[model samples]
Target: MEYAIALVVLAAVVLVIVVRPLLGSAGEADRTAELRAELEAAKEAKYREIRDAELDFRTGKLSQEDFRRTDRELRTQAIEILRRLDELD
Candidate 1:
């Protein structure tokens, strides 16, 4: 009887050990999806910022050189983030 109980206990432990990682993978998927969403949002925000800067330039709020510099920098950063997001998927 004691051996049977020990065997059952051992099985339960082993079962838990094996199943824990499988359950944890669901959380990993959720985290990946969340990261992807954030990356997309950031990319969109960068685009919007670039658009706003262009509008500012057109309205004479920003100088030509400043607009070009700001647009270039923002585009580079957006490209890098997009590459990273592509890698994750």
Candidate 2:
């Protein structure tokens, strides 16, 4: 009976050791997925800002020089967001 109890305890320990990493990895995957989604949303928002800036330029709401500067800055930000998204992949 003592040997049986020891065997059961050993089995439980081995099971936990094997399963712990799988559970940890599942959490990691969820976090990565959440991060990817946030990055994608940011990318889309940046794209929308670029489009709005262009519309303002076309409508003469923005001066040529100011529009150019805004466009460059927006593009640079968009590129960085893209780079981060790529790293996640």
Candidate 3:
């Protein structure tokens, strides 16, 4: 009886160990998807900011030097975000 009990316990433990990675990966996949969505949203927001800045420049609201600096900074930030997303992939 004791041997049977031990064997059952061992089997349970083995099952748990085997299944843990599968379960963990499901959660990991969800997190990765969420991260990708967030990254895309950020990209869209950055693009909108650039477009608005361009509109302001065209309307003569922003000085040429200021527009250039702002546009460069926005592009740099977008590039960094893409680099990070690449690393995650």
Candidate 4:
């Protein structure tokens, strides 16, 4: 009877060790989805900002140099956001 109990305990421990990682992976999936959504939203916002900056430059509101600098920065940031989204996918 004591040996049986020991065997059962060992089985339970093994089961937990195996199953815990599967459960942990599910949680990670949820977090990944949430973060991907956030990144996509940020990317859209950056694109919009870039468009607005372009309009401002065209309307003589921003100097050519300032516009180019801001647009380049926005493009770089947008690319990084997209890369992150791709990684999640």
Q: Each model's TM-score, in the order given?
A: 0.90, 0.90, 0.91, 0.83
How high is the lDDT of residue 33 in model 1?
Answer: 95
Two-way TM-score contest, 2 vs 4, winner:
2
Steric clash pairs (candidate 2): none
lDDT of 1 by residue, 2-84 (tens): 99999999999999999999999999999999999999999999999989999999999999999999989999998998998
Q: Write the per-residue lDDT of candidate 3 for residues 3-59, one digit (tens) a residue.
A: 999999999999999999999999999999999989988988988999999999999
- Candidate 2's displacement at residue 58, Å, is 0.9
lDDT of 2 by residue, 2-83 (tens): 9999999999999999999999999999999999999999999999999999999999999999999999999999999999
* Candidate 2 wrong stretches, greater than 4 Å: none
Residue pair clashes in candidate 1: none
Worst 10 residues of 2 by lDDT: 80-89
lDDT of 1 at 20: 100
Best-fitting candidate, measured by lDDT? 2
Q: What are the Cα lDDT values of the candidates?
A: 0.94, 0.98, 0.93, 0.95
Model 4 CA deviation exceeding 4 Å by range:
none
